[model samples]
Target: MRIINNKFNIKMISENFGRYKYNEVDKYIELGGFIGLKVALEKGKQHVIDELKISGLRGRGGAAFPTWQKWEGGIRELDEETFVICNADEGEPDTFKDRELIAKDPYKVIEGLTISGYMRSAKTGAIYLREEYTYMKHELETVLELSREKGYLGKNILGTGFDFDIKVFSGVGAYICGEGSALIESMEGKAGKPRLKPPRIGSKGYLQMPTQFNNVESLAVVATILKMGASEYAKYGYGDSIGTKLISICGNVNKPGVYEIPFGLTLREIIENVAGGIENNKKVKFLQLGGVSGPLAPESLLDTRYTYEDLWDLDLGIGSGAILVADEDMSVIEYIKLANNFFHHESCGKCIPCREGVHVYKKK
Candidate 1:
């Protein structure tokens, strides 16, 4: 639990805010929020990627792919116009970690993306935020504007000449838009739909340019890895599953809040300590680890470590950091019905899989 001793040196946003309150504009500036950009500019691109690669940071957006590898491939394969997209379209029903990052510390996300842009030599970055969370999108935009005005987001950022800028492109309210390829299509002002592999997005992505797509949490960790060496970061969790995770604990919990805990933290610990246990004095029956697409984990696996590799054994995943603790009263069938309804309504009706799939679910 105590990751940092004498927290001033702790570069991560969550670590710095243990007892500190979010009060003034000066509070963030003093806490090394955008300092990563300055460091990246001085140190250069390869140094940034090497640090993340050593940190063993995996993607927090369900798939848990290596973050450094994604950046490296995008940089090496693509030209200067290579893009970085933060998939803030958190359409997962109960997941709100992305929203929390956008609301509480938008600067951290921006800082991380700025580092990536500098390293990849990217001209543009996009934060594809969900339209449902209008307030979060607005707040993120305000923070971005403030950073830009302060010379953190615009040309000659921190006097490094590593030019990068980020824009918030609100999606037209579709859950599937969270997918990397679907996001690219949406950004291109077309209907959001997944593109086929063979020419994967990393090689040819985002308006036909190689793009590195990361969830908000994954990018936020990049901010810390830049400050703390990767070896030190790897000490936190399992092999290939290093660094902490930001999970949104909701549904039937006495307290529902997003907590950034180490990777191996148990499900029980999350439900009892972080989420303040079950609601209405009810007993927890089961847990839905990811969002709807994620497989359900029974009570027997409560002691399991919340990691990508561990979840993979059960054919489940920590998709989108959505930890829904279902009480005995919650109906599984009803929940499925609701999720199906969402899919049905949001389907663009373009592809056979989505269109016919939605139709079948709608009829059900």
Candidate 2:
């Protein structure tokens, strides 16, 4: 599964991407697309759970929370009809990994969501697509129909009594909808805003039912773990960062594109080897590991690697793997101003603190 990268070789998740053409279900079958769902059917739910627990895969949308831990809480604790949701809003400024995944291999997301649905014993699944991606709705709908026809989705999938179906909920152009609870709200025909949690999303989400939602990348990896097995996937990453991550590198790079690389690669290595170094041979002043919310890493820490354990030690959150590199000439003040501007516009105005804080900062 060699990737078509402009620069250096990336040793990660792009292997099976673009293998099939335009929802060609037969090609998907031949190339082993829904085999993960097939494997999931054979392995059973507990096996699915245990395998992910061992694989150490986490939510790739940014939080980097363990996959197993999330499922364990919902699957083990509650006894109610659950729903599986996929947060495809992809509202982050620099993030494009989800878009690429869906655009290239829409089936992978379907297969992953289907597997997740079966695992949760869910009867329904929904992908909350961002409003900007409304154009993809027809294509996605076509893909869903194809999946159902191929027996990957719909009632009694693959001759198993695991009845489930999916829908695409094209949401408003609100960045806040990227949050699971907020997405759930949007799905429920309410204003898309983050919910206050004591009864967290897993306990009471999406119509006040037990809901399990994952971002596009995390669910896709569920399919990977089922097919390749946990230990095999675990072999890629070092220590706690035990799997490949889909990184979308933009801004001031020689070759800018998404690359799926294993954990433990330093920021320097990624910018140099993976991305072919800075754009136009200009010196980089800093790198923003995640999007606007992610910490600003100085050029001195270019050696810093992107591992959950290592990043946690630095008190940095990997909020969806969108890396932006800036040259030495870029002013930090201008960066701050731009960030404030985005925050100002995207504040949602649901909360006074968030709204007023940005407004005050702009005034000051």
Candidate 3:
């Protein structure tokens, strides 16, 4: 639960992590907790979306899709029944930022989801909690209850007549359910499996209604963007990839924990300055950005910037923002084998390519 890079001054979500007991509603409000929601209610829905656009806040859930576009689509759908979901089924290996967010600052997520519901006029919001995180479910439920008592949840939030409520649905420990469509399906009481695109989650999702799906980190930042003003938040990150990102660095790093880092920092900077270099002062062998499925980068690629465009250019993705650093003592083949085994076990077997490909790779 260690957080670094606080001195850099770009701590949007992590700003109040250690300042106070954020889990309590009063303490969170003392440090500007639901003020973003209040601002969103005051400015109206379109204003929120516009600010999100100006903020350049892409989806933090690996896809890096435009957050504003999804909200725009949900508004345009014209479906009376719309749903907003916070994808908290963080099954990515070494990625624990979402869990930390939920445990430390559940109110931020609740406010973000409520604001999202306001954006889409959605009555229902869901935080798809991972099964491994079930232990925190009671704590979250208690917070939700407190929010309801405080008039943050249920009908007529903040005297604005914007009625929204959130429910926490624990995942069944299926990694594939981390995908948007599969998460929707699982919520619908079906087996967790990825759904085919075309009727993207924007149009037909969650009981065949227009749904806005956002990752835990993506939704969490929504409140920050609105509270701090989009222009102010947008000034933090690199071009296109604006605002800071929550990166969970582990595997041979001296400081293995989550760090809020501004975009455009080199991989070497993150590994060395941020994570305090490799463990035992060993030389670096390779680094895996995002997660197990993310591309591997040797020491030669350490200079590359961590922006979305830079990673995409190298066929790399900031999937789940999990950085697994391997020292010279580790074997690349063994690492790949471990990753392959994970995929082989986690694949839903609905898609032939992923299903058979993982099996074949495991056999190899």
Candidate 4:
């Protein structure tokens, strides 16, 4: 009973498709879920990293950096304490998929981070979730505890002599903390703000360790790609950018939730099929392709594919994989003003441009 045009039924990492319903473990066992981890335990470490390089998977977060490249940075670094940080802060107003993933399929996220921790021989890993997602934090903590008990986390994972542990850290509600450096800082018990480069997170993060930070979606996909050979995962998306993306459809969509679609799918198709189109069949006047940081695209360009290259052509970004739609009758200026107010209120006063700019807008 699969939709012909949409491949939503296909499971990404497991036969479970990250289902966290009651009795998920028995369901995963019935459908052969977590087999990748089992196979990975048998194959050893290098094979795992090799599978990821061939996936052609770029990060789904706003910055579509190649996942393999990010992993390589930590893998090749000459450091004893390499780390992985799952960015689940989800501060973007238009973003919700991270929270959804955390709440619905926390084990999958943990699985991804666990796999990543194994790949880099990470001493420690953490999921930086926002304090607002209190329920999600609780859910993930339980999953982590379960994983540790199953010998899939903590020392000697899967009896393979791998020692890695994961912690769930809470962010105190700053959008800037969604950035990797700020996330690391907040994890270190400092104010959430960005820092200058040279001694970046990968080089010195989370107590001055070589760190790699990836969004919740990116890490989840990495786990899937690592499990299923890279070539198989690359089959879904279009051209050079391979694999699917989970987009958060909100504002005027009918069936709004986290919809996983291939990269080359058209915006119209996403709106019509994935999101169930606009409310009352109203014409979409403008679309916010990414999060608030992105520019609005005119409706005339709605047919464009939601690929990274296509987005760059429109002078827009796929920030946080957020799709915020606006109706024909809605006022764009007023919407911008509202968004501006949020930025103003959240500014932490450490940076000049963001701090002063947000203050100026607030005064207006």
Q: How many steric overlaps are in each model, in order?
A: 0, 1, 0, 0
The local distance difference test score of each candidate is: 0.76, 0.83, 0.86, 0.77
Residue 177 in model 2: shift from native, Å? 0.8
What would you estimate as the lDDT of candidate 3? Answer: 0.86
Task: Kindly report which residue stretches of model 4 are placed more than 4 angstroms away from their true locations once superposed.
Answer: 1-19, 22-26, 356-364
TM-score of each candidate structure, all chains considered together: 0.88, 0.93, 0.94, 0.91
Cα deviation of 291, candidate 3, in Å: 0.6
Higher-ranked by lDDT: 2 or 3: 3
Model 4 global lDDT (CA atoms, 0 to 1): 0.77
Task: Report the number of backbone clashes for model 4.
Answer: 0
How accurate locally is residue 56 in candidate 3, as Cα lDDT from 0 to 100? Answer: 83
- Report the C-alpha lDDT of model 3 over 126-169, residue by residue, as the tens digit: 98999999998988888898899899999998888888899999
**Candidate with better TM-score, 2 vs 3:** 3
Highest lDDT model number: 3
Residues 126-179 of candidate 2 have per-residue lDDT tens digits of 998899999898889999999988888888898988899999999889988888
Worst 10 residues of 1 by lDDT: 1-10
